[model samples]
Structures are given as structure tokens and as C-alpha cells.
Target chain A: NAGVTQTPKFRILKIGQSMTLQCTQDMNHNYMYWYRQDPGMGLKLIYYSVGAGITDKGEVPNGYNVSRSTTEDFPLRLELAAPSQTSVYFCASSYLDSSYEQYFGPGTRLTVT
Target chain B: GIQVEQSPPDLILQEGANSTLRCNFSDSVNNLQWFHQNPWGQLINLFYIPSGTKQNGRLSATTVATERYSLLYISSSQTTDSGVYFCAVVSSGGSNYKLTFGKGTLLTVNP
Candidate 1:
């Protein structure tokens, strides 16, 4: 399987711009997550979905939105970009709950100017 | 909210040396995992050990849930092992299985 894949490996957006980060998994995982990592820091969850049509906020959900329309797809949207939103974003998936191992995408590096 | 902390924020070692990384949590956890972030920015799952000990190749991990601590040992490390190691956990009794991550321990192995 291709595991988890994310689109737009690198993106730069001007202030007030908007864009959607795409994530897909071939593993048919029931749980999917979006996380952001600042330089020299660990990742923080932005949003997650337990199944299709089920989404929830996480530790740092501000400035972002997400939708899970299919078991293989979960997308994150940024309405108005800000410099604070600049970070490396990762997409992950797991078969079950946290008890199960998670697989991560390569990551998308976003720069907001 | 659960708080996770990793020790030795930075370490430098020669190739073939051994090293240990630690993770400590403030509350009880239902799941714990170790990840390695390579220099190219790919996160790789090393182990999913909530409790007990597990070993893989040159790496081994042990988690003592009662004490809320975990340790990762790398034996005969190589330059490829140089990167950041992160420890994440899911607090016990939480409906959401989101993971709380520690800042991470950065390792630099020189050839």
C-alpha cells in the first residue's frame, strides 16, 4: 500500500489567502489526523476524524478546518492564512484507536507571509 | 490535558555509540509511541509500546505505565540514526484518542 499521502509538499501563501491541504490513505484506516510541527518542536494535532462525516477539534485547531467525506480522504482547510500558521503539516492514519500504530505522510511545509 | 516531557533535548555522539532517550508523562496513559523524524522531515514509527518492553534490531523500548515513564535505547547507532526522537501518549479515560507529544530529543551522530 502507498500508506498515507499528502499533496503540495511545499506551499507559500500570502496573508489572508486560503488553501486546502489534502490527505489520503490507501490503508483504509478508520481514524485519520492532521498535525502541525514547528521548527525544533514535536507535532500538535490540529484536527481528526474517527470516520466519515465525523470530525473533531484537537489541541491547536484554530485557523484550520477539516472534513472527512470518505474513509480514505481527510482534508484540512485554512481560511485566512497568517504567519503564525507557518509550519510543517503531517497526515496520519490508524486502523483503530490510539492503541493501534499510526502511519504518517511525508509532510507538507507551508509558509505564510 | 496531559503533559509529556522528553529528556536531553540535544545529544551529539560518534558513530557506533549507544544512547538512551527518555519520556515522562504527568498522567496515566493508555497508549504510548516513539517516532523518529529524519532530517528530510519524514516521521517514522519506531515502536508502539504502552507498557512492557519491545526490541527491534538495534533499537529497544520499555515503558513502565505505573511510573508513567518510557525509555528508548539505540545500540551501535549509525549516522542514519541522527534526527529527532519524539514520544507521544494518549491519556487514560479520554474519549478522543489524540496523542500528546513531547518536544523531542535531538540526536546527532557523526561519522
Candidate 2:
């Protein structure tokens, strides 16, 4: 299986610009998540989906939105990019079971200028 | 919100040396995992151990759920093992799908 995959390995956005980060998983996982990691810091959850049509805000969801239209896809939308939003973004997926061992994607590095 | 803390934020070890990384959580957790982020920026899941002990090759992990702490052991470390190690957990009382991550322990193994 392809596990989890993300698009646009790197991106540079201007202030107020908007973009969507794509994430897909072929593991048939019922749970998907978006997280951002700053340099030298741990990752912070941005958004997550329990299943198709079920999405929820995570720890740092202020500047982001997400949608789970299909079990295979969960996309994160940035309405207005800012310098603070510049970070390495990661997408992960896991089975919806007692053991939520998540598998992560390669990550997208974004820089807001 | 649950708090997760990892110790020895930085470590430098010689090749073939052994090292241990620790993760401590502020609350009870239903899920705990260790991930190794290589220099190339790929997060590889090392262990999905919420409790008890598990080992794979030169790496091993032990979690004491009751104590809310976990340990990751790397024996005979190699330069390839140089990277950031992260520990994440899901609070038993919080959303099962959300994981709180620790700052991570950065290990540098020199040949």
C-alpha cells in the first residue's frame, strides 16, 4: 500500500494567499490528521477526520480548515497564509481501533513571505 | 489538553554506543508511540507501545502506563540513527484520535 501521501513537497506563499494541502491514504484508515511542526519543535495538530464527511478542529486549527469527502482523502485549507503558518506540515492516518498507531506522510514544507 | 514531556532534549553519542530516551505524560494515556524523524524528514514509527515492553532489532521500548512514562532504548547506535525522536500519546479521557506530541529528543550519533 502507499500508506499516506501528501502533495507539494514545498511551497512559498505570500501574505493573505490561500492554498490547500492535499493528503491521501491507501491504508483504508478511518482516521486522518493534519499537523504542523516548527523548526526544533514538536508537531501540533491542525485538523482531523474520523471518517468521510466527519472533520474536526485540532489544537492549532485557528488558521486552517479541513474536509474529508472520501475515506482516502483529507485536505487542509489555509484561508490566509501568515508567517506564523510557515512550518512543515504532516498528514497521518490510522485504523479506527483501540490501537491508533498512526502512519505519517513525507511532509510539506511551507514558507510564508 | 494533555502534556507530554521528553527528556535530554539533546544527546551526542558515538557509533556503537547505547542510549535511552524517555517520555512522560501528565495524564493517563490510551495510546503511546515512538517515531524517528530521519534527516531527510520522514517520520518512521518505531513502536506503538502504550504499555509493557516491545523490542525490534537494535531498538527496544518499554512503557509503564501506570506511571505514565515510556522509555526507548537504542543499542549499538549508528550514524543513520541520528535524528529527532518523538513521543506522542492520546489521553484516555480525551479524543482517541488526537495525539499530543512531546518536543522530542534529538540524538546525534557520530561515526
Candidate 3:
């Protein structure tokens, strides 16, 4: 199974523009997360979903939003992109009972100018 | 909030040498895992070792929960092992699903 898949492997956005980073998992995982990593730094969680329709904020969720309408999909929206949002984003999923052993997809490299 | 720290920041090892990387967490955690980020930037899961010890080929990991730290041991290292190693943890209870990653240890093995 393609454990997890993310769309638009790379993207560049202008200031005030918007875009969506899509993530999907065929494993039917009950948990999904969005994280961003700056150059030479650790990842910072932007948002997470326990199940479809249940979402929560994480450490750095200011410029991003997420929606989980189905068990197989979680999409992150950048409403008004800024240069500060430039980074690499990763999508991950895991089973409910796994206690957070996640499967990460190939990351999306995003640049906001 | 929990803090995760990994060391020695940077390491350069000769081929066939052995090395150990460390991770220290500031609070109790429900889950822990190790990941290797290769040159191309893909994160590969190495081990899901919250406690105890586990071995996989030339690599091994030991997490001493009581001490709030974990160690990853690599034996007979090769050039292919050159990459960044990260330690991520999830806090106990409902927040256990969110992982906080360390800055990572950069390992370079020269032939």
C-alpha cells in the first residue's frame, strides 16, 4: 500500500496568495498530521486530526488550516502565504492503537516569496 | 510542552567505525521513534523504540525511559550511513499522537 501520499511535491507562492497541500493515506489510519521543517531544524506541528472531522492546533498553526473530511484525506490550506512560510512540509498518518508510529510521505518543498 | 534534544550536533566517522547518537527528552513520553534523513531528504523510520532495546542489522537502539533518554548505536558504519538522525517523541495521554522532533545529529561516514 502507498502508506501515505502528498500532492504537488514542490510549490512556490507569492505573498498573499493561497494554496492547498493535499495528503492521503490508503492504510485507513485514524490519525493524520501536518508538520513543517525549516532549513537545518526539526519539524514543527501545524495541525493534527484524531479522526475525520476532529482537528486540533499544534505548536505552529498560525498561517495554516486543515480539513479532514474523510479517513483517507487531510488537506492543509495556506490562506495568505508569506515569505515566513517557506519551508518543507510533511504529511503523516498512523493507526489509532499504534501510539503515534507514523508513516510519512515524500515532503512538499514550499517557497513563499 | 516537551523538549527534545539530540547530540553531538555533528559527527564525522571513518568507514567501519562505530558511533553512538543520543537523545534526551525533557518530560515523560508515551512514544518514541528514530528516523534517518538521507541526502535526498526523505525521512525513513529506523525504529519505534519507546523503551528497552531493539536491534536491526548494524544498528541498535536503547531507550531508558526512567532516565528520559535514548541511545542509537551504529556499528561498522558505511558511507551510505551518512545522513541526519532524528529522535521524535509524543507526550503521554491524548497528546500522544503529536510528535516533537529533535534538531537531529548529522552523521558523515568517510570511506
**Candidate 2 residue lDDT tens string, B10-96:** 999999999999999999888899999999888999999999999999999999999899999999999999999999998988964
Clashing pairs in 3: none
- Model 3 local distance difference test score: 0.94
* Residue range A80-113, candidate 2, lDDT tens digits: 9999999999999999898888899999999999
Kindly report which residue stretches of model 3 are placed more than 4 angstroms away from their true locations once superposed. B93-96
Docking class of 3: medium
Arrange candidates by DockQ, descending. 2, 1, 3
> What are the chain A TM-scores for all the models, listed individually?
0.97, 0.98, 0.98
Q: What is candidate 3's CA lDDT for residue A69?
A: 94
lDDT of 3 by residue, B3-111 (tens): 8999999999999999999999988888899999998889999999999999999999999999999999999999999999999999774453789999999999999
Interface RMSD of each: 1.5, 1.1, 1.4
Assess each prediction's global lDDT (C-alpha) against the native. Answer: 0.94, 0.94, 0.94
